[model samples]
Target chain A: MTNRWTDGPGPRLRDVSEDELLAQIFPLLPRGGPVVVAPGDDTALVRTAYGSVLATTDTMVRGRDWLDEWSSPADVGGKSVAQNVADIASMGGRATALLVTLVADPETPVAWVLDFAAGLGAAAAEIEVPIAGGDLSSAPAGTLMVSITALGDVDGDPVLRSGARGGDVVAVAGTLGRSAAGFVLLQQDRADDDEDLVREHVRPRPPYEQGPVARSAGATAMIDLSDGLVRDAGRVAAASGVRLELSTELLRADLDRLTGVLDDDAALGCVLTGGEEHSLLACFPPEVALPDGWRRIGQVGAGEGVTVDGRPRSGGGWDHFHP
Target chain B: MTNRWTDGPGPRLRDVSEDELLAQIFPLLPRGGPVVVAPGDDTALVRTAYGSVLATTDTMVRGRDWLDEWSSPADVGGKSVAQNVADIASMGGRATALLVTLVADPETPVAWVLDFAAGLGAAAAEIEVPIAGGDLSSAPAGTLMVSITALGDVDGDPVLRSGARGGDVVAVAGTLGRSAAGFVLLQQDRADDDEDLVREHVRPRPPYEQGPVARSAGATAMIDLSDGLVRDAGRVAAASGVRLELSTELLRADLDRLTGVLDDDAALGCVLTGGEEHSLLACFPPEVALPDGWRRIGQVGAGEGVTVDGRPRSGGGWDHFHP
Candidate 1:
C-alpha cells in the first residue's frame, strides 16, 4: 500500500496522536448551516426545515472497492460522498448533512485521512451539506475503510420509483459510460492517455442540482446510475410495473461519445452495463418540460423490465461482491 | 470464524445471490409510522416533526470490537444498535430511525446476516425506530464490519455536555461498572458464575427511556459512558470548563455490586476506568429535582478536568486506536 502512494511528502497516520489527527481533520469539516450542533458532540443536531428527511449509507473498502495505486485518497473520499448524495437525489431530496466513519489500520498515513477528508468536505460543501458527526476507529492491520451516512430534506411530496405511469417519458440528467470507459482504460494501462476518463472513474460528478429540479418539474420515478443504466432502469420498471423502452437512437449521442475510445462491443456494453456513473435516471409525465440538462431517452409502457431499441437487455450490471 | 459459530447452522452468504440475501433480510425489517419509504430504495424517507434531528454513527468490527467466539450475531447487532442509540440519548434526543451497513467476506454465513437483522430490527422496534435503508458491499476475506447511524428527535433544547455549570449535581441514569466487571469475569473464565454480568459484556442494557427523563427534569448537560466513567466525566468537565468532583463514598454502591466478581482494586478500577457501560452521565442544576432512576455521584465546580474526592484521576480510559 505504501508503494502505491504516488503522491509524495507526508507522515503516516501512525506517527500522529489520535487527538492531533482529529485536530487537523476538524477544520476541514463543514460548519454553520442547518447544523445546529457540529462535530465533537455525542450526536449532532440538524434542522431540515421539512417534515421528512431522506437518509442513506454506503461504504468503500480498500483492495475491494478501490486500490490505492489507482485512486488518490481524495478520489476515494469524493466518490464516497458522491454516491451517498446521489442516493438522496434519486429520492428527490437535497442532502443536508453527513456523518462519516473512518476505519483504518494504525499504519495508514495521516495524509491519506486528511486527503480523504478534503474530498468528503469538498463534496459536502458543494451541495451545502454539512459534515455533522461521526466516529473514527481502528481496524486490523492493512485494512482501511470508510462508511458515510447522509441525511436529506424533502421540500415537498417525496418522489419515489413507484409513481412512473405508462405514458411517462424516460430521461437522464447526466453522462453515462464514461466511468466504465475510464475503468477499462485503467485496466488496460492506457489511463495515461485519458485523464478525463480516469478522473471519471475516480471521482464521479453526480447531477445533484438536477434532483430538485426534476422534483419541482414532476419526476414520476428516479434512480441514480450506480448499477448501470439497464439494471437500474430495470429496477424502476419493476417497481412501477411498466416496461421501459429506451431508444438507442436517442442514446446514439451516448454511443458517439465512446466510439473512438472503445471497440463497438465494448462501447455498447459500457453504455448499458457500466456502473458508478452516479448520473440521474428518471421518468416524467407527458407535458412536463424537463429542467435543463435532462435528455429524453425513452418511454414507459404497460409491460415489464427494461429494453434497448425494443430489445430486452441480455446482461445485467455491476455486482459489488463479484466485481 | 466458523468454529466460533456455536449455534445451529444455516446456509453460507455465498450460497445465495446478494438479491436473495437482501430478500431474506427485508421481510424482517421494521416499517411504517414515520418511515415514508422503507428499505430496498435508493434512500429512506423519515419524518422528524421537530425543527431539528440528532444524528450519530458507530461501527463494530469482528476482531477488534468483538470476537465471534464471545459474541453471537444477535449480540453484535443489539450492541451496535444500543451503542449508537446511546449516543443520541446522551444528547437528550429520542432515537427515531437507524441505517445499517454490513460488510462481510463472500464466504460469510447468510444466517449470520439474517440473525443480525433480526436483532437490529428488534432493538429498533423496541425504540420505535425503523431500520430505514443502507448499502451492502463485499470485503476482503476474514473481514466483517457493521456501521449503524441513528437519527434522533430533540423534542426541546438539547442537553449538551458544555452546559454543565458550577453547583450542578453529577449523576448517572443507569448502572455503571457492570460491563467492565463482566469483561473481567469473562477473561477470568468465571463468567459461568454470573450470567447477568456476562450478558452485560455481550449486550449492555442502557436505560433508553431515562435520557428524556433527565432532560425533562432539567439536566444541564449529559454524556454516555461508552469510553468509561472517569474518561467520559472528564470530557463533560472539560467541555463545560468545570471540575467534576466525584465522591468515592457515593460510588461505593457501584463498587459493592462488583464485590464478589472482582478484587477491591479491580472493582474500583472497573467503576472508574472501564468503558462500554453506555450509561447516561449528567449534571443537573442545584435547585432542580432529580429524576427517579438517576443517582447523584458527584458535583460540578468552577475548575478544570475531573477529580475523585477532590484528587485528580491517575489514568485515562479507552483509546480506540491504542486499545
Candidate 2:
C-alpha cells in the first residue's frame, strides 16, 4: 500500500495486473512435451502414454523450506521440480508435464517471479517435460508459497514400497547426505569452504533416469530418499513387513564424502539422517544384477524396522509439523 | 508453540507427526475413480482415457481468498474442488483425478484439517472423481494455503477459446451474478436477510455435467466464468478475434432474480461484473440448437472486445495482484 512497487530496482507484483505478469512469465517457461494445449486456456491438454498417469504434489513455504539469503529464486524453482520429479521416478514413471502454483505477497518483486520461472523451465526442459499450466495468486504479507504437481506415465507396472521381499538387495542411485551437509555448513557460516556441498543442498540433481531403469531390471520396491535414508528405509521396511540390514562398510563411500567437511560422528549422522537428498532407493531380487549407477547398501530380511550392522539405529529425519 | 497443541478441544498439527496426520486424513478422502494406486505410495497412478489428459491448477490463501469468519473449513474445501472442477469442465473434459496440497501453520487445528478433508471428499464423490495424492507442509505462523491440480480426459478434441467464429450464438449454462451478489451481501452485513446469497459466495455449486453436454452439442469455444461475465467474455473475444454483442433484455431473468435483494442498477452490475462464479459461458454455431441447460444471451460478430447492446462496456473484474 505504500508504493513499494515504484521504489524497487524493478516493478513489484502490485504494479502489474495478473494478465500482465503472466505475459512476462509465460515466455520464460518450457513448452511442447506432450502438450496439446498450452497455457492461457481454462485447462491444458497433455498426452498420456499407456493409459495410466502418475500424479504427485509438493509444496514449499518461504521461511520453512528455504531462506532467501541461502537460496536464489532459481534454486527454489529447480529444487521444487526435482523433488516432484523424484516422486514420479520412485514409482517407475517418466514425467510428462507439470502444473505449478505460486502464492506470493503483492509486494514481491517481479524479478523474483521471472527468475523462478526460468529456473523451473530449465529443470523441466532437462527432464523433457513441459510446464503445462499453473495458477498465480497473492497471499498475505510475508507469505510466499510454491507448489508443483507432476504428471507422469509408466510403460509397465509401477514399483511400490510394499513389494520388497526377504531376499531383496537394497541399493541407492545417487549421492547421500550432501544436501544435509550443505545445510549444516551454511548454518555454521562455512559455506565458502565447500562449494559442492553448498550447491547440492541448494539445487540437487537427482538421478531420475535410474528409476525407470531399475524398474525395467525388476526392482521389487522403490522410494525417493526425501526424508533421509534411515526414516525412508524404515518406511519401506514397515510397508513391506521386513527388516532392512545396512552395513556401514557398504555406506563407506557416502560417509567418506562427508568426512572431509565434518567430524567422524557428524559425517555418519549426516549420511544416515540427511533430508531433501532426492536420491532413489530401491530393492531388487538377489539374483538380479544392480543397475549401472545403483550401489548396494543393504539387504532385506525377515523382520521389521531398519538396523545398521545388525543393531537397531535411531535418530529420525525431518517431520513437517513435529520439527 | 507454547502448548497450543494441548489446550484446544482437538489436537493441533504440532501435536502429531506428518504420518499420523496423514493416517487420519487418508480415510476422509474419496478413492477409486480412475485410481490404479491410491495414497500412501510415492505417487498415485490414475487411468486416462483416449490418450489425452486435461491439466489445470488453482490455489487459495487465507485472509485473501477467504476469511474464517465468513467461511467454514468445509466451505473452503468444497469451493476449492468446485473451482478446479469447473475449469476442467469448461475445457469439455471429465475430471479423472485431483492432487491437493495444504500448507499451514504448526498451530493449525487437526479438527480443521479433518473437516476440510471431509468437505473435499464429499465434493469429489458428487463428481465421482478420486483424490489421488497430495503434499502437506508447515508454513510460518498465520499462513494457511490450499491448492488442487485437476487431471481430466476428453472424448474428442477439446473446445478451445480460439475456435469461435462470427455468427455463433453465445450462451451460459449456470448462474452468472449469484456469487458476486453473495459477496456483496456479506460485505454489507446483510447476511441475516439473504442466506442464499452468502452461501453462494462461500460455496459455489457449479453445473459440472453441462460442460461435456455443450461440447457434444457442438460448442465452438468455451470458457469458465471464474471472473465476471464481462471479463471472461472479453477473453473469448480476444482469443477468437470476434466481438460479443450482449442484449440486456435477454438477461432480464437473471437481473430480476437479484433485484429482489438489490436495486435495479446494482442487480445489473452484479450480473455483469461478478467474480468467483464457476458457470460455463460458451459459443455455438448458429445452426446448432442450444443445449437443455444453456440460455442464449448474446451473439458473436466480426470485430473485437465485448459490447453490451451495441455499446462498449468498461469496468474490469478481479485482478489478483492489482486488486
Candidate 3:
C-alpha cells in the first residue's frame, strides 16, 4: 500500500491518522533488546537482569530548549536521548529501555518526525537500549516537545549523590564545557570555527560503559554534569554533607583546549560554568584505583559548597526557569 | 527558608529557580512505595517484584487534549495519570512507579503547578504508587504539556490483545460513554446540567483493581478503552484475528444512562464511540465466570472486524490529528 502520507508530496501530520503515523514510526525506532512485548501492545514489557529499575525522564522544548534554526529534528532527538541516558549512567546502571513522548503541532511535517525517530533509534541502538514505546499527541500550532523516560538495571546497589564522604577524591569522565563553548560559538555565529564543539552541543556521546566500570571500582557518589561543574558539584556537596575542593592546575588540559577558540576569561568561564555537558562527576575512596578514562581533579573536605584554590566559589549553572 | 516564589502572591514559574520550584513540588507529591532513591537523585531507583517491567507513556497538551477554561490544572494532572495507569492495568499489571514531565511557558503560575502536582500525587497515592521523579522544562509562551510514564509489575504472563479465541466472551469494567457525554455537555455549555458526567470527563476513575481480577479469572485478551468502545474492540479484533460480535441490548444500560442528556442516536453514539473513558475491555472463555464489576457486552467469533448484532461495524474513535 502506497501511503499518501509517507510517499506523497510533503505530507503533514494532519494528513494521516494516528495509527498510520505509528505504523511508519514503529519501524523507524530501535528494537530488539530485552523486549518481551513491544509497542503494538498496550504496554511494552522488558526483562530486567536486576530486581530494581533506575528511572529518569527529561523533556526538550522547541523554541526554549532548541531553535529550529540551529538544531535539526535529528539533532534534537539524539540530544534528548543523550541527556536522559546520562542520568541512568550516573546512577551506576545501564539503560534497558526508553519510553518517548512527542507532542507536536498538526502542521509538523511527516518527514521531520521520521528523521527524528531515525536519529533516536540510531542513538539507542548505539547503547543497545530499545525504544520500547511512547505516546504521540497533537498540540497548538508552533509547539513541539519531546520527552524520554529511561529505565535501567543495576547489578548491585545504585549509586546516589549522598554517598560522598570526607577524604574521597573527585574525578570526572568525559569533556567539560565543550557544549557550553558550542553554545557560545553558535551565539557568536562562529560555529564554523569549532565544528567538534558545535557537534558535541548538538549530539553528546555520553560514556555509557564507564558507569558500570565506575560502580565496580567503588565510586562513592556520582552525578551527570548536566549543569555547570561547580553547580552540579555543589549539589553533591550539599547532598553528601561535604565540600569539594578543586584546583585549576588539574583542569589545565580542559581550559587549554578551549583557549584557541575563545579568550582566556571566556575559556575559564565555560570550563567552570557551562551547562549541558552530560559528563560523569564521581567521587572515589582515597585508596581505590581510578578507572580508565577517569580524571581526578578535586578532593572531598569537611565543609559545604564548592571551592577553588582554598577560596569559596559560587554555584553558577543553568536553571530552566532562570535567564 | 521562606520561598518568595511559593509563599509570595501569585509568582510565575519564571520567578523562581528550578530547584526552588522542585523543592515546593517534592513536598506536595506523594512518596513511599517501592522507591529506593527518590527525586533528589540523578535518577530514581524503584524495586520491582517481577523481573520484567510494564512500561507505558501518555501525553496531554493544553489546547488539544484539554482547554484551560474547561479543565483545571488538577484535572489535567489527574487525567494524565489515569490514562497512563490504565494502560498498565490492561496489561494485567499494577503500577509501581511513575515519572512525570511537564513543559510549560514561563508565565505559567506556580500555584497552577502546585495544584497539578498535588492532584497527580494524590492519584498515585490512591493506587499506592509513588511519583518517583520527573523533569521540568520551560516552553514558549502559551505552551503547556504534561507527559507521564508508568512502570508496572506483573505476577505472571501479561494478557495480550492477540490472545482471544472465537469462543471468548467480551466484558467491560467501569462506565462507558460518560466521558463522551460529559464532553458533549461541555461543548454545548451545559456543563452545569450534569455535574457527574462533566466530572467524569475531567477525572476518570478507572477500575484499576479489576484488571488483575480479570487476569486471575482467566481473561483471554484485554485492552483499555481509551478510544471509543467499538474502536478499541476493533483493535482487539485485529490483534486477535477474530471478530467481536457486540449487542446493543447488552449495552442498553450504558446507553440509558446518557439518553436523558441527549437523543437516542447521540446516546448510543456516546456509548459506542466516546473516548477517554479509561475503562477496561477483556475477553474470557465462555465457561469462565465473569469477575465482579465486569458486565458482559459481546462475544468473540471467527472473523476479522467488529460486528454489532451480526452487522459489520466500522471503528469510530478520536484521532489526535483529525477533527
DockQ of each: 0.11, 0.12, 0.12
Candidate 2 local Cα displacement, residue B289, angstroms: 1.2
Q: Candidate 1 — which residues are off by over 4 angstroms?
A: A1-50, B1-50
**Which pairs of residues collide in model 2?**
none
User: What local distance difference test score does each model get?
Assistant: 0.75, 0.78, 0.77
Candidate 2 chain A: 10-residue stretch with minimal lDDT:
A1-10
TM-score of 3: 0.85
In candidate 2, which residue ranges exceed 4 Å CA deviation?
A1-50, B1-50
lDDT, residue A77, candidate 1:
85
Cα lDDT of model 1 by residue, B93-184, tens digit: 77766667877775555556555666676666676666555556677777788998877776656677778999999999888899989888
Q: Write the per-residue lDDT of candidate 1 for residues A20-48, one digit (tens) a residue.
A: 54355334222443434333211223444
The 10 consecutive residues of candidate 2 chain B with the worst lDDT sum are B36-45
What does candidate 2's lDDT look like per residue over B1-323, in tens digits? 32221122444232444344335433322344444333321122344442446668888888889878788878888999999999888878777777677787766655466557777877877777766656667787778889988877766667777778999999999997988888888889898778988888899999989989999999999888887898889888988889988889999999988987989898888899898888999999999999899999999999999999899985475657656
For model 2 the local lDDT of residue B235 reads 82
